[model samples]
Target: MTTLPTSTQKKLGLVIDLDTCVGCHACVVSCKGWNTENYGAPLSDQDPYGAAPSGTFLNRVHSYEVQPDHGQAALVHFPKSCLHCEDAPCVTVCPTGASYKRVEDGIVLVNESDCIGCGLCAWACPYGAREMDAEEKVMKKCTLCVDRIYNENLPEVDRVPACVRTCPAGARHFGDFADPDSNVSVLTAERGGIELMPEQGTKPVNRYLPPRARDRTEDVDILAPFLDPIAAEPQGFMGWLDKALTAMPGGR
Candidate 1:
């Protein structure tokens, strides 16, 4: 096993908001589209068109129904990716030193050319962030769009990770966690952000903002009319549709 550097200069990572995420999979697609091309190799799909299609992806979103002991069932959207941990066990488990963490920015990455595909990194990660590319026979994980973030050719505003840029709900955020005043840091502090499976002691840089609290005291009327004033006051688009329906041959 290898050893990580004593300390990283800066911690650049993401802060995901579970409450705001709608599980739209926009981030997932954006990450795949960008990373597959940004990095040297394309993301692989063994049986893309087959009955049981599967592919390697850097970003994954999962939805879970959490029924608390004393509260209502909450639908939570969880987005997972390489957390770029401080004491990354994935780095220490690499026999060939292919898996390593950047000393300057704390981004964990793999040297594909030197990789042996031992799957040790995947086993070392508690969050299940690593993926295996069957064709390349290499272990892969999220690079945090390292190429995009540092590319000077791209527009100034478009230098973020594709997942962050394409998140329709603004659920994903990117910043330097080392800065206590950074947006990611403030949001984490305010929202009580947490690491996934922290017991593993990886000290993951990426933080997850738990679902926010909502008021459930107000009751919703389940039997309410679908359309309000549809026939009583025909005014706009819905009114025109209602009027046309009434003027049909067998109209009511």
Candidate 2:
């Protein structure tokens, strides 16, 4: 008789708190550190110090200014990466059978040794989740730090993914999404969390809680740090430098 494997007791996943994110890059850096150290090859850089800089990363934080044409500007910083979809297109499209989902905990993984680097999985993803490792010649994306999460050798508090552990603002979380009582599930429910590109219907497991609204006029300066303002062309030494830089001496 044909029989499917029994699902595990938990479906592990992540829930991100946009309200608390503070747009810090700590999670990004932590992800880089962990993935580079453990994944087959480090996230490679192409022309890193040269023009047209690019690299492969499993996680990237995207800063967006979400202003409706008639409304106030709301800045949103999204950390983009694999959502590890339940109906992941990346899995089915893998001609080499490298991409797979674990029925045990629902975390998707790529078998790097088996990958042929066809990039079919990359095209199947609408979120642009997958990237090719130029050096390894294989597909790469988030593993959710699978080795760390289930490692019995680590301390209980450090068992989560590196990104979740290093987030200074407590913006990221890792837990069993199948358990409604789990922290991830509860937080998602409480915040009325949203999923990105839901229309694509990949059934992404990650959730993003929206940021709280700020009073446009009163709280605008709260965003000043991100804007990086400098003294506007003062009438002194700095002003001279600024004018020199802007006008370019030989220019008309």
Evaluated with TM-score, which candidate comes out highest?
A: 1
Off by over 4 Å in 1: 218-252
Q: Kindly list the per-residue Cα lDDT of model 2 for residues 1-252, writing each as its tens digit.
A: 011124545678788887777778888888888888885668888898998988888988888888877677777888887897877878887777678888788777888888888899899899988899877788889999998988899999999999999988888989888899989899889889888789998888899988876655644567768888765658788778777887997744
Residue 8 displacement in candidate 2 (angstroms): 5.8
lDDT of 1 at 73: 93
TM-score for each prediction?
0.86, 0.80
Per-residue lDDT of candidate 1, residues 70-180 (tens digit): 778999989999999998999998999888889899899998888988999899898889999877788878999999999999997889999999998999999999999
Best by lDDT: 1
Model 2: lDDT of residue 195: 85
TM-score (C-alpha, index-matched) for candidate 2: 0.80
